[model samples]
Target: MSSSPSSTPWSTPCGTPPLAGGPGGADALRPLVATVLDALHDGAAARGGPLPPGGPEAVTAHVRDALADVLPDTGTGAEEALHALVTALAYGAADPAHPHCAAHLHTPPLALAVAADLAASALNPSLDSWDQAPAASALEQLVTRALATEIHPTGPAPDALVTTGGTESNHLALLLAREHHGPTLQTVCGANAHHSIRRAAWLLGLPEPVTVPAPDGTIDLTALAAVLTDLRGPLLVTATAGTTDTGSIDPLSEIADLCDTHGSAFHVDAAYGGPLLFSATRRHLLTGLDRAHTVTLDLHKLGWQPVAAGLLAVPDTTMLDALAHTAPYLNPDDDTRAGLPDLLGRSPRTSRRPDILKVAVTFRALGRTGLGHLVDRVCDTAQQLADLVDKNPHLDLYERPTLTTVLFRPTDATDEAVAATRRDLLTHGHAVLGRAHADGHLWFKATLLNPHTTPTDLDTLIALVEGSTTR
Candidate 1:
């Protein structure tokens, strides 16, 4: 027989920690949250910059020393363990909130969204079945439909499925194409497309993608047309809305028109630029987005939510029938027939966290206009950075800011010098900037995503680069 709570093994001197759910959960969590908040503040204070000083070895040693007693015979208790680990992690983090941390597509999450995430964690709703997440499943439906409608406004019934991120969204898009047209689907993408497209095609047993040239950062229309004409099987032309190395949007309407002419299905990997739909001024950049058979969107990149806020949108709900799966226990036919929403087919993974909660909260708290303002802010900041790069005789701007990525380097620095400067910044914890190869040279790629970054911050980044290059 199962022992009573009082007589359980954990109830001895060790003392079982209070659970995070049910009636008493809030009272139990209050002190623990305070501990965590304190720890976070202390850690960030300790870490004085965007990243901890002294690169990999120092950071690793610091973490190792703090966490030496992993799986110890006796616990350190909840508060101690929480404080120690949280503080260590926060201290060692490459904090995106720092204006100097304009490296990758990583975004610093909003306070409101992060707070909503806490509620999600405490509730711990698994989205595998309707019973597991009744309200969450309903909320997911409402939010997904609304977003899908925004993407495919003219469609009769648009729908979307939440995914882990761009990689999974790309995989699902390919999987759907494979399921509909068999394993013979051949993907065609520009060289500028995200690496996930090639990986997804391989995972789905589809032929390797026919990569067209992207010499000018965007795809070459004539080359793409030639490749599509030469190919003779089931074709899926994958286009990039925002490229990785350089944020350049392909000519969407022209590509969509080409797809129509060639009788090929179109898919846009808008993972980085999808949120441009929120910006009234920038939505025109994704003009033919609705024409795609599938679109990949990653909110984590541009939408300042936490990691893993991704989606795959379709023009019609019927298009998602390919992903329809039936697990007897999770989504029984009787339950579905009796008006219960079938949750199994929504995604490939079961037992998923309600990531939608944070996203929903963010959307409700900040409507289209609010979100649009944030988008515009970052893009404008990028333009300001580009202008700085242009004015700086020591720096060379690769091109004008397309979205929020600005590629530049020391005016005449060699590729090796450019690379060394980036590493020097990382090792010294002076700043965190990314590197990209474009126009036959390695350049510093500042992917500015922080809305609060000021003009002074951009000047500081250029000054840092100038200083690094000299060294």
Candidate 2:
């Protein structure tokens, strides 16, 4: 009967590759890293623009051809596989590094951070237990606590959790609130808040949030007050530091006052705008941020780290008590008495990567001043883009940007034409721009996250949009 599965003969795993850890790991990785680097350069050279020519079908076909034989009977060897796939991906990538690729909040990762990520990958530390990630666990604690203190200096004992990104951070915020306030917790947020906030509430089986008007993209204080006054029982008021469609921050102090008046919990989704804390010039934009019970921050958006660098900070370590859990295999009672750090409670996730290493490296490499410079650079570039749009008689600026996002559209163009212009630009691989509806019109949304963007780049973007409208 199938020769008894356990007794079935099996040949040694084919083409066993060298590991990326231990003494010989570096020696083994050196050549493969070189191969990857060369492939990246060659592929990016082939792309020659912000994105590969042709749309989805062309990209899919190219990748399919490059990655032929996804599960080959015999191996093609590690170097060959790495080179082929990496090159193909690089060629097909929507490169955030290209100045014209200013579509979303996606940041071009910092080289140092990426390099640090490589080390983290090599180490392959699983953070669910201290034994698997001894030094890494300590590093995470140090870095997260330091960041928490930055956000809540007045807090009794501020602490933060390393998250995958804003989505996960927002999810954890809602989860923690649910644990504290019970299932009856009602979430109140602005119409302009990130969609994740509502999703988080739904995932937790909580009541559908009550939405307040964001008339000018920031919450209407009077409207929020009215809602808070009417809503009974436990309430959580979620505010937006920077809105997605328009980068407008709610009046934080005013909202906090309402929350206080109603005795409701407060949370701020600053996923897009939290990094302004680094900039001395712009820190005032986030005034009253510390008043929130929980705050979400995403470094991948503006801090220039690779994807998956997000944080959920609380004023005190005790505030996270609701997440405490025990797993005998991971963190046993004896281990705790012996002072081994129990990591399972730090997040809802169990199998977590050492994402903190890259963030720590970035913080060490670039102190407050260096990071502030990057923030200011992008903001300045956005202003320049707005100026170009405002001056172009063919274009109309939605508003003067408060942060790095600039929304503008062709003057007097139909909403349909505005949408088509964005599509035409995407199809032709000319530029990557986003679209947002504001002031009852669809506008071309240029979210400038690349600090390297220049006035010349902004001028070209305006010209391209103007030309597309005519076409």
Candidate 3:
């Protein structure tokens, strides 16, 4: 009834397929390299807030125009084609380093990490097999052990690996739990848990999640026991170290005890707050991370790394056996018999990049103390903003910031009005702060990652919010 699928992935039976192009992959990317340098210069000169001066419609139109301008034929040469693409990205993309770009969890990348990425990209190490990545295999193990130690110190290096981000970390954790505990397991998480947990459940075909409400963005411990009382099978309980909207951390010690009592697997989504472990003054906040069965951390969020740098650490290495699979052709039993390190089973994706190099470079460049200072600086900014909001009659500070995010709103704005203000600010290139709705109220938020933003920048942002409130 159906036509046979094309034999080759690159082409169909009818339309002509684009060639992989003549030799020289590295040589083709020079234009992109040059364009990045140009972008840096042009971007700095723009002297704009986080984003360019345009709202949603304007952004869409600009992207469409760029796409339309790209030559359909490859005759324009790799240099010209790549130059145009990188130029579009340079001018169109928002700059997280900008003082007013406090809308999301995005962070400005460190220079050293960027250099590491350039090297890693050039090397193109695919760590699926030792043949593909020999040294990289060892490098990943060394870095993984170090990170696992950071998360669960005092114990021998726990199981660990790098992932795309928190979502993949959560997915891998659940996949392991399901393989160990079985398909009969039920997933549980606080209402404030990252959405990835639910997605993981669906992918695993587990039962509907029993979500415990997280008022104030932290789980109500009193209600947690009641929710788990009726569960019938093996369970996975996800705790949040830093919730998305409010940056609230759950009572991890208490949650650990409950999971232990019920024989359920515990996973902590510390994608945003995991960096607190580095802060000597603030390490107390993540004290219970060591007790988690599995803990997730995202280097891209606050670790000053480029995107797609998620990590997972576990106390028991054997738990990862659930994800182990044998491939007679690629990672054959013969290889295992020879005692070669085949690390692909620990993650969902087989052909993975050695992102650990950049992570290793980040820690080396910014040691624990330096990174801790950055964390403290952001926390200080959050407190300063909180106090400013408290003093300002037009602004309402909702909760004391537990981490680096401050949730608040204008004293005189409605839910729609708050959204309207954000749109206006973006359209006019004034400021762009986070907006969210919870507890039957609309709120604005600021996630301060850029320590370079001075008190004057903070005051300017507040003034923008105040001015918007009156309008």
> Please, what is the whole-model Cα lDDT of each candidate in the order they appear?
0.90, 0.90, 0.80
- By TM-score rank, best first, the candidates go 1, 2, 3
- What are the clashing pairs of model 3? none
Which residue segments of model 2 deviate by more than 4 Å? 1-14
Local accuracy of candidate 3 as per-residue lDDT tens digits, 1-471: 212213322223234433222354344344446656775666445534567676667767766775674446434433344445555665666778888989899998888888888878777788888887888888888888888888877665486878999999988888878878889888889989888999889988988788998887898877888777778789888899998898889999999898888887889999999999889999899878898888999989878889879998987677677768777755888897899877668576888888989988888878999999988988888998888889987788888899888888887678888888877777777776887678788888898888787889999999997787677
lDDT tens readout by residue for model 1, 1-471: 434334444434488767889987786677778878999999999998899999999999999988988899987767778789999999999999999999899999999989888998999988999898989999999999999998999988999999999999999999998888888999999989999999999888899999999999999999999998999988999998988889899999999999999999999999999999999899999999999999999999889999879999999999889878899999999999999988878999988989888999999999999999999999999999999988888888999988999999987789999999999999988899999988788999999999999998888888888888787
Off by over 4 Å in 3: 1-32, 43-47, 67-71, 154-157
TM-score of each: 0.97, 0.97, 0.90
What TM-score quantifies how close candidate 2 is to the native fold?
0.97
Clashes of each: 0, 0, 0
Of 1 and 3, the candidate ranking higher by lDDT = 1
